[model samples]
Target: MSLAFLLLTMGLVCLVAGGALALNVRGCAHALERKAAGNAELAMHARGELGQPQLVMSARLYRCLGTVFVLCGIVLTPYGFLELA
Candidate 1:
């Protein structure tokens, strides 16, 4: 039961964090778009280096990752139940 409770708590934490991250990404969509465009331009101008634009943040990537995390948390939270019967 203790372990189950621990899992449940961790799952809830993940869910909250993932939801917050997803919402944050949505709130900053415009800024992310501009940053992405700048990164693309920088990448196009790279001559000898193919990794010049490694500092850019991808909104789609974060959104998908967050969604996956939220899903995992949802699954985990339910699995924390001590008994189904």
Candidate 2:
């Protein structure tokens, strides 16, 4: 019920979400590889380069977000626990 407990809960939620994001990204990358197959352009995009740059950017963004979320969750949860105790 305390602020600390709220922070802890939010932190855990973020951590879990981050983990899911990571898993999703793994699947996405695999799918991209498969889709690229023998297409030079598509393969370039899959490699995060000269084709569909957005794909690369998006993947990087998601990965960055996942890391940030997990880190924030780790920091917040411990701090919340300390406050609660």
**Top candidate by lDDT:** 1
Q: Please list the residue runs of candidate 2 whose C-alpha ends up more than 4 Å from where it truly belongs after superposition.
A: 25-56
Any runs in candidate 1 off by more than 4 Å, and if so which?
25-52, 55-57, 83-85
lDDT per residue as tens, model 1, 8-84: 98789879877766676546544665678787867667755555455455776666767887888898888887432
Clashes of 2: 0
Candidate 1, 35: how far from true, in Å? 11
Residue clash pairs of candidate 2: none
RMSD of each: 5.4, 7.4
* Cα lDDT computed for each candidate against the true fold: 0.71, 0.69
Q: Where does the lowest 10-residue lDDT sum fall in candidate 2?
A: 51-60
